[model samples]
Target: MIEELQDVPAGVVGTRVSGRVTADDFRDFKPAMDRMLDAGEVRIIEVIGPDYEGFGPGGLLADVKQGFSTLTHMRAFKRTAVVTDKEWIGHTLHALAWMIPGEVALFGMDELDAAKQWAAG
Candidate 1:
């Protein structure tokens, strides 16, 4: 699930994705993400740690829908730092980084602080 994280740097929206992410997770988390998007600029820190079990089908669909529906909002993405130990996630994000309008970086789970610093920058 996408559980919000606190104590992050200013202007950074931090979240942790763990366990089986279901539709309910997004239902509860979308508002914060929407608010970030509405602000017209986004510096996001996504920490997908060892506990992450991938997203449920519904959650995946919701994510895809939200992303595709706001293609223009890609420009609002200032920086995205993904902190994870998952190899697949790192590969996927690396492959898709070019599609994002801003910097997209991958960090080891232990480097969350560094990720936050990069995102906030």
Candidate 2:
């Protein structure tokens, strides 16, 4: 499931993901992002909990579609902060960071506050 983080400052969009992620979740997620993007450039903070069980096949496809859509308007995102305890996820973000237009930072679960601060900036 995906839930929007409600306490973030203006210009920053945040989401918390747990359990199994599905295309349906993106259905909810995409609109929030679109709304934020429509306004102007925004920063993102994603908090992936330990219960996250990866994405379903449909979610993967949805991700591809959403990814392309986001890339098409890549400049809309100023920065992305990911908070997770998983090593693999952090490594993956680190590797992908070099290819992305904006900055991407990974933080351990304990550093969620710091991640939010960074993304808010």
Candidate 3:
């Protein structure tokens, strides 16, 4: 599941992902992101909880579709902060950051506050 995080700085979108992420979750998530992007360039903070069980098949497809749709607007993002304790998730984000137009940082779950601060900047 995915739920929006409140009380973030302006122009920043925050979300927490846990349990099994489904297409339904993305359906709920995309609008919030679009709203942020529509306003102007934005930063993102994603917190992956220990209960996160990865994405469902439909969620994967939704993610791919979102990726293609946002490919041209990648520069609209200023920063992305991923908070996760999983080493593999951190490595994956690090590798993917090379292709992203903005700065992407990975922080341990314990550093969620730091991640939020960096993303809000």
- Give one digit per residue, the lDDT tens place, for model 2 in 1-121: 8899998877788899988889999887888978877877879899999989999658889887888887767777788999999888988887888876577888899998898889888
* Residue pairs in collision within model 3: none
Task: Assess every candidate by TM-score.
Answer: 0.93, 0.93, 0.92
Off by over 4 Å in 1: none
The TM-score obtained by model 3 is: 0.92
Better of 1 and 3 by TM-score: 1
* lDDT at position 65, candidate 3: 85
Error of 2 at 72 (Å): 3.0
Which segments of candidate 3 are over 4 A away from where they belong?
Answer: none
Candidate 3 residue-wise lDDT, 61-106, digit = tens: 9877877878768778899988998788878877788876688888
Model 2 whole-model lDDT (C-alpha atoms): 0.85
Q: Rank the candidate models, highest TM-score first.
A: 1, 2, 3
